[model samples]
Target: MKYGKTLVNDVKTTLKVLVLFVPLPIFWALYDQQGSGWTFQATRMDGYIGFYTILPDQMQVINPLLILIFIPLFTYLIYPAFAKCNFLKTPLQRMVCGGLLTAASFGISAGVSFALEATEPSLPTEGNCQIRIYNPLDCNAILTAEPYIKNQDIKTMGYTNLDIPNVYGEKVVDFSITGCDGKINYQTGSNLSVIEKETLFYYMLPDSFVRGQDDIERDENGLPKIRTLVNKRVEDFNLTYSDSEKDVLNLPSNDDSLFSINPGSYKVQSFPKELKFYLGGVYTVLVSLDNNNDVQNVEYYEVTQPNSVHILWLIPQYVVITAGEIMFSITGLEFSYSQAPVTMKSVLTAAFLLTTAIGNLIIVIIESAKIFEKQSEDFLLYAGLMVLDMILFGLMAMKYKYINMEQNSDNEELENKSERKESNAIDNPTFKHNDDDA
Candidate 1:
């Protein structure tokens, strides 16, 4: 009877240890989703929700809510059934089951990725445009005049005097005479002189010219006579010149002469309306000026869709990470307690909690380091940390040995004391003696 009672006690202790360990793996699996599966799945969801901005990580709230609800439900409803069932009476069994579920989560995510890819359309090409201006010049003209006087001492003959209007529209007495004298002379009526002696004389008018004036009596188009000008002032006339006219006016001869002058304005027409795609599934457009310094083109483009494999592959990664958490975080908790000395059970539980606290501290330290030294690829850095975590946990599992407190002398003594008390009660029959005295 003592042996049977001892066996029962041993079974009860083992069962209690198993029960405590079972929940650890489950909680760890759920917690790991915060970083891996939940984060990975969030990236695939669209942010637009009518008029609100939604951060991708915000989806993680669902995991916490699930944990809050499921933890209690599982403790009350699911844990009892496991306790009654023989199959779930071990930490190893619970860890294995948790790992399988974690894997299943990743499998679901992979399936979702494929479904999303099949439904989504190919990205559209971006469009762009550019403008340009060619060349420019002023379309104005300049004019100048000079006067000449005559010396009559030379033997020269002069023609009759005539009145002519000057550029100022004032009538002036002038003489146009031809003579053998090489020098030409010009005089106003007030300075005119008559001499009886006949001599050869010539008169030359000042080299004065009108600007922007018509040169030919009939223009090249067979028009009527019009005064020709050397350099015309376009601004004075409030006139604007076109690109073709500006080209003709800017010619060396026309630039100073009254032929034509080009003004400094040109309108560009050609602009591109398309662009090419680049990496990261990110689209970009460019707009710039042309060779002629005009607005060249604005380009548009659509980036290629991300490889379907990326999303599909991450799903499995999520599952594996969750599995790792189940193995290390959850199972480790139970392992720590089961391996600890009976007197230090609370300390062992504290150590299990400390692992999580240390993990969080590590993450915080990494993030702070990033603040000091900016990380170019934050996602890669985070992934590397996770990989490190998995490695560390695996190593710990391999090297660690569970405590065998059941064999301790102190525990054996406590068990023997309880057994002796029970035996004394059976041998002395205390209850029977009390009833007989009554």
Candidate 2:
């Protein structure tokens, strides 16, 4: 069934639609980051708000939540106001504004990233050793190291981090721990090699001390790595997570070991410690004892404090992006349908979706390239790309002739009805004889 009359025109219209769609993928690429890049950014931020805590992944809810609010707000208030101003009169104009807002959202994110980077702890330089001490004793402990740290006071049940000269093979650094009065209690006079560019954590416990290398490996998706430093007293412990159970056995007195676990709230049985773990975090759980040698409490230390930057800073970016989504994505689809030829609606819709998939592919390519060392740089780069894409889209939109498919369909239907009536009168012999008699 070939409709030869409209075939050429439909093909020409479809080609124009494809040209207009060329820049849409970039918009989707930036918009889709609310799930990936934005969520990851939230993971490193503090989620506490008064009495309630918002998880990093839960930040995505803001998009949909705002969408519901924005849809009615735009329909009733915003669009009406814009109409009076003679702005955003067409879908193309709305989509262009949407793309601009998307770029602006990334600009906000980049600003936030710059702020966060300033507060973030600096990584150890090559040929340097970064060490943090966890003193779980009832009294404060003063640590003295030769040739580097003179006297650093690590408070009771608290930790202090320091960077020192790296000790390579065949050499050892002397370390002494004492009370506040400078009375030496523990000393490491033997050979202890410290690696450069690595973080070493020392746990001070009752009757013994343990030291382990910090594992800064991030959790991918929902799998987080948990390193448990069990006090010698607790023989075995069972961890009940949200989905599974992990039983740790026979760890040495005050010894720490690292293992991966599903991210969730964990209940440590046999010692009664309930804790919640977030995504992409490397955690150090310390089970300490009191003066009476009984189980004191459980302590948690994250290698990189994921909750340092506050999550509320993300609100501005989210708001802008959601607004952009309402404008760019929805309006783009609407524009595609309205401009499409009668028989080409389905094909254009599929092409619109294909642009979204291509946008995601762009993300993969950028991520794999490892172009930027800092996340802030990555955000700025995306923003720049979005601006460039919007410029191209705007140029295409200017040249695009808006075709009213509904009006054409209505006229075609009217013509078909008129033709049927004419045929009926011509086929009637009585009407022809009446005309001949008249």
Candidate 3:
């Protein structure tokens, strides 16, 4: 320790690193949302790109994949250009630039979210009910419901959405579908009790099936719910799960039956045909007759549109955030190691990592407090916070003295030696007498 001279330098270096830790957790809090907030965002968007569909959970892979590509690109090409321009000369500058990019990425996400809010459909308000009809038959069908929706012609395989506010709750209403030149005149006065803020999906199937009882249970995890309404007698009805589990499901003829299953791809095999189910969905499948008026098919419809905003909108945000990570995350670690004293390198690294935990804690606290009304607003708030954080970090960096540990150690050794020589001179009476005579 050179009689504590080196220890002073080491302590100072440690304090500087600790100061850098202040703004770091905010970055981590925003970055770690790839698993939670970002995934939830993907769920509201459409995952279809060409023929392949991307899952919301799979979006997390974009970070690591971009890291692999960005590491080399920055190391070999991008950083060199910046170096030539006399830019980002220090690790601190790169980290600041990276933080700005992080803020920019979230800004882009906010814009996408605003677009989603505009394009996506809204749920029925309190005391109001929404309904959509699906016509799977080949012939065009005319739907009629007095005092709620006008007589509209729904084309073959097309659907129409209607919103009704307090349409005689628990009271029966006359609803009819006419097609096939009036050969198919289906009428019903059943009380389709579509409660307030609930969506009822009705499919006009060519089968003699009665409306089944409604199962009122809702899933807490927000997983998908599937309900099968058997209109006719069918055999070998089953659901084939992607996780290699198959169950022989049977719905009593002309009754409402409900079943809950995990979220994944599932194939429903029955007498009519096969239908595939997606994740986090609420679906109702009705067994019905084909255009032949003979029971031979089943159709399923969802309560809400699963993918209205395309997943591709997320790509730009992901790219920007990944680039920022490549610049900020990697440079921060390097700076922490290089500036730390040799004996405390590992401790500073651990301190740098602790910022991530703190960032997550901030998120948990704010979420529990319900500080924001909308997620877009929350994102904007984070972006704003990050900007302020970067400003503070940049100011701190300007004051931080970048030191070479080896050079500092040598200087400390020289200072210690000089101090010892001065002490010896003061202690020796002959040296003091000679100095006094001179």
Candidate 4:
């Protein structure tokens, strides 16, 4: 009776419990990218941090290091300082503050990518050809681009990806990729201009390399079917939007808007109007106006020109998001226990764990949807969502009245004593084990 009463009667406790889950999935989704997607981003950026050259995967170590620094610093120093200033007196307030910081960090991360996009991909190289294989698995794989390139071994265990260094110095570098199942599938790319090093992008994946032994399976046609990406051309789009929608899109000014359904099938751009693709790449633009609202869909593509940006650019987002994790995740755990009635504490704890699991699942769902292609826009959307969560939670938190745990414990003790007295008077055989009753 007491357990069920406590569970149902505690309106304030229910609200506080809901607060624990409101923004959790969003937080975890972004947090998880630090290990998976963010590491991929690190692959493309220059990894030389001061004097140390950090590997892409090793960049995840910064989160734990930051957590170690945050725990003591926030507990002993920062929280106390904030308390003195009359803010962050409640866990909810601290969580909101942390969420803002997290948003800022993602904003900074997007800024770095934006900066990289602004630069033209230009590099001078004396080498004839280079062969790169993107091996995602831990096992060593051999790569060969026949005729112009051959027998290039790639190891992805410790390194991000392998650029067969020995293949350089040849003048006619052919970009050929012979996959295990078909004809050569490959990319044409300019070496990211470095002072003296090669550049690579973690966000992109190299095709599975073909082995020397697999060459015998080729059909007798001497020519093999080429693998192709499904790039839908912009001309194929059936767009319906007002002038306001066009302005909102803010497409690149260099790309000409003129088009004609021709008698002779001729096409033209105003001087500089070649397709606005990244150097050594082709792209298909996706446009739409069926949104039913004023909101316009905008997309910008970047074919990263190897090592164009600094890796230090990722630090701001990492710092901000880590600070958020300390505030929300760490404090949310403690808050859940504090507010839960003794009989329902375990239930509340399990609910909190459920939020994290669901949060991970959200990332998998979003990726499979394939709707969000740009990382920058995605970061902004996440930041906006978190801010909205903070607003909603802040409102709910304002109405919450904390439970007096010590008082509840005392009442519980009294109830237990009264029950024992009743059992003693009844001379119940199940309750007769204790010798002190004699």
Against the true structure, candidate 4 reaches a TM-score of: 0.53
**Model 1, residue 251: C-alpha shift (Å):** 41
**261: Cα error in model 1, Å:** 50
Alpha carbon lDDT of each predicted model:
0.37, 0.76, 0.71, 0.51
Model 3: per-residue Cα lDDT over 1-438, one tens digit each: 354766776887799789877888999888988888787777766665655667777888888999999999999999999999999879999998999999988898888878766754476777787776666556787777665666778876566767788654544466666663543445544544455667665655555313333332233333456776543344543333233366545444433455655545554443535555444455666555443435465566675444467777898999999999988999999999999998789999999989989999989987888888777888898899899999999999999889898887788789989988977874556554556677
Off by over 4 Å in 3: 1-3, 131-162, 166-195, 200-225, 232-282, 289-295, 415-438
Error of 2 at 108 (Å): 0.8
Task: Give the higher-TM-score candidate: 1 or 4.
Answer: 4
Segments of candidate 2 deviating more than 4 angstroms: 1-3, 134-160, 166-189, 203-209, 215-255, 258-293, 296-306, 410-438
Query: Ten residues in a row with the worst lDDT in model 2?
Result: 235-244
- For this target, which candidate reaches the highest TM-score against the unseen true structure? 2
Q: How many clashing pairs does model 2 include?
A: 0
Best by lDDT: 2
Query: How displaced is residue 286 in candidate 2, in Å?
Result: 5.9
- Mark the 10 consecutive residues where model 3 has the least summed lDDT: 208-217
Sorted by lDDT (best first), the order is 2, 3, 4, 1
Q: What RMSD, rounded to one decimal, does every model reach?
A: 28.9, 6.7, 6.1, 23.0
Query: Which runs of model 4 end up more than 4 angstroms from their true locations?
Result: 1-20, 49-52, 119-305, 419-438
Question: Model 4: which residue pairs collide?
Answer: 105-317, 128-170, 128-171, 177-184
